[model samples]
Structure formats: structure tokens, C-alpha cells
Target: MCLIFRIILTAWLISSSSLSMALSIDSLRGVEKRKPNVIIIMSDDQGWGDLSMNGNPNLQTPHIDRIAKNGARFSHFYVSPVCSPTRAELLTGRYHPRAGVYSTSEGGERINLDETTMADVFKEAGYATAAFGKWHNGMQYPYHPNARGFDEFYGFCSGHWGNYFNSLLEHNGQIVQGNGFIIDDLTDKALEFIDNNQNDPFFLYLPYNTPHSPMQVPDKEWASFKDKSLIKLADARTGEEDVVFTRAALALCENIDWNVGRIQNQLKKLKLDRETIVIYLSDNGPNSSRWNGGMKGKKGSTDEGGVKSPFVIQWPGTISSGLEIDQVSGAVDLLPTLADLSGINYSIPKALDGISLKPLLVESNQKWPDRMLFSHWNGKVSVRKGRYVLDDNSKLFDLTTDPEQRVDITSQKPELTKALSMAVVDWKAEVLKDIAIDNRPFPVGHPDYKYTQLPARDAVAHGTIKRSNKYPNSSYFTNWTKNGDYISWNVDVLSEGDYAVAVYYVCPADEIGSTMQLSFEADKLDFKIAKANASGMINQQYDRVERMESYEKDFKPLKAGVIHLKKGAGELILRTTALSKTNALDFRMMMLTRESP
Candidate 1:
């Protein structure tokens, strides 16, 4: 009996010791072997010279500089000259032209539905993915961020926003008012997302819409730059640099730096700093030319300043500190690089234009192949191979000798020039082969989406109605004085359902009784304006400089009853009937909530 009891005790002791040893090994593995979280912060229209680290003495950006200081910096990073094209390239590991993104606004900005996004790959790998801030991709479902594999999305889906201070924004598919300054509001959402997903592998894309235009900055950030004298001026070639505009842009940049610091602090607080990878870059060049490291051209050009962007990546305990990579890279490389770093197995739907930069990022003395990157916008194409660039005018410049691209070297190196020119022709025929007008109608009533917002930016004004601004991104329809004045949107409703319709407009007390009809093909909902909402112009106090876009007003929502939309393509028109006053309310947006299918 004693021997049997000893045998049972001995077996119990052995099992306990094995369990304790296994837990110790798992605890060590949890700290060292877990997948790293990724946070990519992209700024809109911020130049390479916008940071102090980039030799811009006018402003200081220590927080942003720290990312470069701690990890790797790309010396020759490139992107598109515009917003949407660059965004599309970053999302997909392909040229923007291949993704059907030819323009910044309207339907052209929408990426091809079949192309897979970086968020989609991460999300499919069980990572919590979210994007906060400007999403110029598309606004409708399937094309929307939610359908593009971001579990959460909070931002405006426009080329540019009218107001930046506490303006109307969207969360997923529902319209929600922003909390504070647009940049801060986006950062707040991003911090919260990080906090919630700290335990899990997460991919957070914080695309900050700032320093773009309608140049708005917070009071604290503005106070330092408003009265200060500027040493750095724009290129003397234009000789028309607005100092106030430059100051406003610098102020906005400083505000972005502060927000970047906030993100770093959050990561440290959550003890996820070492286990997280942070990448920072800009979508395009500076909107206005202002001291961009002697690089020619600004936002709209294919010159060095227009496409050259600062790319900084930080991953403590992984990537080496203060490493400088001189190899030329572009936005297209982001998807493949990130997927490789995370060690996630993802198969792209199509052949990727970009190769994984893992060897350059992680290994020492890695041999890289010479590659040519092409930049195209508005029918202009520029090819960059090695240190030479063939400009849009079919002129080649050796960048090693002339960084400003002032001299044409095509005659000097005829063979290289001829080869590059023919390559451009082949690229255009292949990549830009299908690049044409995107006549696809604005989609609505997506079966999976509940709320659909048809803003005036997407509307076409007919008769006497006109857009408030030439740039249709954030403009409103005005001059609807006559009964015949109407606005229409080419729409494709995906579901047969009754949608609770509402019009966002500003009507004076005198124009309160104006009758309006909202129609989609044969189905129409007619309603009379009962209440008057004369909300004043917003962003006046917030605007640091005169804006090119229209000053936004509080477009109050007025319920216009319900409308039944059939599943098909047609024009959704809004026409006034009994115009009681001179104008039938300044049109802004039409909101439709799916009620019944």
C-alpha cells in the first residue's frame, strides 16, 4: 500500500514540473515571436522639405524626425503628383493607372473593384484593420473602405474637404460630425483603435488630411507661425509665392508633428512600441511651392519636387537604427514590403508592379536590381531609371549632376534616351491602355450598406444651377432660382428598397414653402420645405488663409419622406417646383437610409 501511494505521488510531481516548464517557454515566445502591429501614417500634400530633419529650418518636426532617427529613411522615395493616384498605388501593389485611377475627384478616383488592397491582406490574416482620415478611393460599398477590408473607417471620401474644423465626416457608412480639428479628430480615432486592438495584431492606416488647402490649423499651432518671419521662400521661378499660404502650410505641418508625437506616446503607454512598426510618408508633393530642397515643380508637375516624398519607417528590435536606403522606391512597394515584414502569406490577385523590399530593409549588403519607375498625370509621363529622368517633354536629365532637371541630356546620351522613350511608349500602351473616362454611375443602395450620402460634389448642375466653386470636390449647388433649375447624379441603385430620404440644404424663412421632387427613374418623392434653416458660413474663424473652395455652411437635414429605388442604373434628379423665393435653398447633399427591401 505504501509503494503504490509513492508511485502516484511521483507521477503527479512529474506532470506539475512539465506544465510549469511549458508555461515559461510560452511566456518567452509571447514576448519574442508574436506578430508585430503596423501603423502607417500618411500626410497629404506635405513636401519632402516640410520637416526639419529634411533641412527645412523654417519649422521643427522632432516627433516625425524621431521615426527616421530610430529606423530607416528612403533617400529617393516617389509618389504621384496628385492625391488619389498616389493613394491607389499605396493601397494596391500596382501602378495607379492599372487600378483605373486617372483623376482625383468624381468617378475617376475609384479603384477597380477587383484589385486587392493592403488592408484586405492583413484583415484576411486575422489582423484588425482600420483607416482614419481622407479616403479618396470611393464612397460606396464594395468600393468603400469597409468593403475594401478595413473593419473600421472614419473619414471623408473626397479629393479635398471644405471645412477642417469640426466638420461632417463618416464612420464606416454612417455620417457623423467630427469632434475637433480634422487632424486631431482622426488621431483620436486612431489612438482608440490602437488601444482596443493592443492584444491583437492590427494594421492602422492614419491618412492625415492636412497642409492641403483651405489651409486651416489650430490656434496654438498657428500662433507660432503667423507673426514669425520666414527665411525659407518658394522657388524664384514662379516669383508668385504667397508668404501667408506658406506660413499656414508650415503651421499645419507643425500640428501634424504634434499629433505624430501623440501616436508614439500612445504606443509607449500601451507597451507596444517595440512590437509595433510605424511608417510615415506623404501622398504627393507640396501643394504650393515653398523651399523643397531645390527640387523643381510643385504639386501638379512631374518634376522632382512634385513626386519626391519623404519615407520613414521604424520598427524597434527589428529594423536597424538611423539606416539610410538610397535605392529608389515608390508607393507601389508599400504593400509588398509590409506583407513581407509581417511574414504573412498573401497572394495578390494580379501580378504586382512592386517587389518586396524585405532584403533592403532587413539584410546587410543586399544586392538590388536597377528598376524604372514611371509617373503619369494628365497625359504626361515621366520615367526615372537609375540617376537619369526622362521628363514629360521627352527630355532626359542626368539627376546625379543636375538635381534641378534644368539641363536636357537626351542629345548627350541618345541611346539611353531613345531606349527610355520607347519604354514610356510601351508602358503607356500596356499600363494606360484602358485609361479612359470612368463613366460608371455613382452607386447607391448597396444591399449591405444602410446609409448612402450623395453630396453635391457628385451632382451635375443643370439649367441655372451652378457649383459654388470650380473645384467640385467640396462645392455646393447654388443659383437654383428658377423652377427648371435642377441637379442630377448618374446613379446605380443596387437594391429594390424604400429609403428614408433627406435633403441637406440651407433655406431662408422666405424660401420655406419651396416644393421639391427627388426622383430616381420612375420613382419620385415630392415634399414641401416646411422649416427654414439659415445656418451661417462656417470655417471663417478657422481659415488661416483665403481658400479656393467654397465656404461651407451648416446644411441642416430636412426629411423629404421616403423614396422607392429599383435595382438599376438611372439619373437621380432633384428638381424644384414651387420656388417661393429667389433661390430654392442652397443644395448640399442628399442622404438616403435603407428602410425596407
Candidate 2:
């Protein structure tokens, strides 16, 4: 009986040890497969309320809402007040100006190639990276996405694309013509990149340019909105003479939603659903259209409407479903968060003002550090910390209670306001210190935008107009006499295209011919002067004018301009530049928009 008992005990011990060994092996395999494929889908100028989930009664964004339902929705996500700056923050995990992008016009300001990027971190971690969409970073050779860390690049290099139906896109280094809608083309390229790189870990950035200016949409999408009564109502409220609720903008949103669904479905089809992480966000707040998530202000302003954006993330089997996090976050947080998730190790550049969000994602109860996030546009700066926000004008708000920023608490809390104001000033000083000057001479010398001597006078007067030798003889015409004066400036066009001559001038009077001019040298071109009758105008009586006339004349190929100057300096003589004598010409800012070759 004793021998038999010993034999049973020995067999039991052997089985237990074998089971332990097997469990350890499986644990190691799980760790090996833990790295996730990351996808960041960003929309251009899409407001927080534009999605169906955000309570927009007019627009439907089912696919975007899915990300919120399946994973987590960030109720308080912030971004720069404009596009390029927000993009810079997203890529470098730092303030926009620190990464060399202060505004959309700062295209020549390159994001230092040496700076560590979110894509660089993922690529270094063995993830194939691709950015498919509007890459408004720099279009110069060294600053393109390919030159950065992206393995494949497809999209426009400019801030906005003019035509969505047929647009000029840059594939890697080559500019290519894309068919169909721009949104679809971007999505198609993204899906192709995903399919090609499905076998390996990958990072995909899909930044869709939609719901922006030149608001347009395909006919089929527009048809869905034809029956809606809200469209007519909104038009009536705004006193809009033309279509107020643009079917194109609505269709664009729907198209973006469809693309989101396509990407999500692709992951499921590839069996990568459980291993992929997707993040959806907007580059900035919405432009003047649709719903702005009930927030105040719109694009270009430092208000909530300009900075607040919709942010959602989904990771099947990892993130909890239907979770809502109301913490404050910004585009600057993306880099560190992505790096943490992908297991990438690298120190960020000096003073990178972002905190990693991996702890928040993995542990719901984790507390974020009390840190400040900053944003700027057009010299306006805003700083937010916890529930408090400080703007340039010393306005303070407890965002926790007044998310709309309706009531200012500066007078009530003087000390707090002073501290916040100082913080912004210090931060701005740091950013300015980091701006590395572009010593390289301007390829197309300084632009020739008219500069007026006085606020009201509209007559070309004394001022030396400077330009790049690339376009020699291009001169700026400023302070021009508004009545019966013709001003002709010469431009050496480096390339031929459907060029539109645009001039920024002030028409303080509402009368017709308050500003009138004709471009005789190029072609017989005339354009009606629209009043820049913005609410915050210095002279409310007269409207500011920025006139643009289409010059449909064909020109010499390869050369700057067909009409050369006698001494390589062309004449920009002005005469009969009529305007209401009561309405003085303010300033003249000139630039040409190249349509096509």
C-alpha cells in the first residue's frame, strides 16, 4: 500500500512542473506580440461638433463615432489655433514655433530634419511608417516627408489644396495628378500602404483636407442634404445670398467618415484588429461652417472654437470600450504617447512640453501631471493648465466651469492672472530663443506685398521694394493714390500658370469704385473690390479690400516674365487707381496665386 501511494504522488508532481513550464513559454510569446500598429487619422479644420456623436444634428459621422465607442473619447483635447502649428506639435511633441512652424505662411521654416519625430521613433522601433495626406510641413527637397522619417509619402505640401476633384499631389518627391475626390485619393493611398505593410508593425498618418475653404463635395453626397430644412434655416440666419449650408462641406465630412470605416475594416480583414491602435483627431478647430461643438470662436482666433478639437482612440482588446476621458490634452502629447505605446526609446529635444499618455490609456485611474499646454497663432498666445486658461489680454477662465470662456475672472483673481501671464511670456521667450534663423538667402527674394505708410492713404509713395533675385525686378507698390492713378509693377514669373493678381488694400468707404484698378500689362483683367468689413476693423465706415483678378494671359516658358525690364528692373507705374475720395487707400499687399502650368 505504501509503494502504490508513493507512485501516485510522483506522477502528480511531474505533471504540475510540465504545466508550469508551458505557461511561462506562452507568457513570453504574448510579450513578443504586444507591440501595436498605430494609425493617426486627422481631419483639416473639422470642428468638435461636426461628428454625429458630438451632437451635430446636421452631419453624420458614424465611422468616427465608432472610434469613440470602441475605445476612448477625449472630451478636452486642445490644439494650436491653426493648422500648420498644430501639425508641428503633433509631429515633434513640442510647441509649434519650437519646431520651426509659427504660421501657415512659414512654409520656408523647415522642421529641423535632425529633430526626433513620432514617425522616426516608430520607424526606429521596427515599424514601417507612412504619412498619407496634407503634409503642410515644408515642400523643399530636404524637408519633404521622405526626407523626414516616412517610408512612403502621398499628399499636398501646401496648407490647402484648391480643387478636391482633381488636385496636384506630391508622391514622395514627385508631384502627381490625382483623380476623383481628394479625400478618396488620400484614403486609397492609405489603404494601399496598409495592405502593403500589414505583415509588419506600421504607423499610418492620414491627414484629410476637408470642410475647409472652397467648400465643395461630390454630387452624390450633396444629394443627401437636399431635403434637409436646416440648410435653408442656417442660410436665412446668416443672411447668406448664396448656399449657406454647403453640401460639399457636409459630403466632405461624410467622405472622411467613410474613409475611417475603410481603415478600420482593413485592420479587421488583415486580422490585425487586436494588435492595431487607431487615433482620430482634427488638426485644429473648424472654420466658419456647420457646428463648432457649441464652443466659442472659430478658426484663426485664440478662442475655444479655434483650439479645441475632437480626439478619439481605439485599440481592440487593449483599451476599454465606450470610455470617456475629460482630461486636457493636446497635439504635443501625441509623440510621447505613441512612443510609449510602441516601446520606442529616445530623448526629445530641449524643452519638449509634452507628457506621455500611456499610463492614462493603460490605467484608468492614473492621474496626469499638473502641466501647462500652450498654443499660438498670429502672435496671439494662450496657455492652459488644468481648468484654467490665460489669454494674451490677461483674461482668465476656469475652464472646468466656463469651458465657453464667456466670463473673465481676471479682476476677481489678480494673482492667478499675473502668474499665468508671466508663464506665457516666459514660454514665448523660450520659443523665440529656439528659432534657428534660416541663413540661406531667399530663393525667390522677399515677397512683394504692398505696405502702406499710413492707415488710410492709398497711393504708392516712397519705399524701397525688395525681392529675391530668383524673380528679378518684382517690386511692391505701396501707398498708391486711390483716384485716377494707375500702378503697374513688374513680376518675373519663374513658371507659367493661371496666375491671379491679388492686392490687399483698405477701402474705408462703401461706394462702388471705392477701389477700382485694371491690370493692363499682363491681360485685360478686372475684379470687383470686396469690403473686408470684419467686426474688429479700425475704420468701421470703410471696408478693407484685398482684390484678386484672374490674368488669363499665356506667358513664356522657363523664363520669369516675357516683358523684360530695360535695366533688369521692370516698371510698376500706377494711374487712374480710383477710389472714393472719402475712402482713403490703406495698404497694398500683393501676391500671385499660381493655378496651373
Candidates' C-alpha lDDT: 0.90, 0.65
Model 2 agreement with the true structure over 429-483: per-residue lDDT tens digits? 8786645464321111112221111100112343332121111111123234346
Winning model by lDDT: 1
CA deviation > 4 Å runs, candidate 2: 1-31, 106-109, 231-247, 433-597
Q: Per-prediction TM-score, please?
A: 0.95, 0.71
**Model 1 ranges off by over 4 Å:** 1-32
lDDT of 2: 0.65
Worst 10 residues of 1 by lDDT: 232-241
Tens-digit lDDT string for candidate 1 (1-597) = 999999999999999999998999889787446788999999999999999999989999999999998999998889999999999999998999899899888778999999999999999888999999999998777788999989999998887998888889989888789998999999999999999999999999999998899898789988999987888788775347788899999999999999999999999999999999999999988998688888888887888988999999999988998999988889999999999999899987699988888898899889998999998898888999989999998999988888888888888999999999999999999998889957788889888889888888888889898888999888888888899678899999999999999888998887788899988889999998889998778869878888988889988789999999899998999999888888888988888999996
lDDT score, candidate 2, position 418: 90
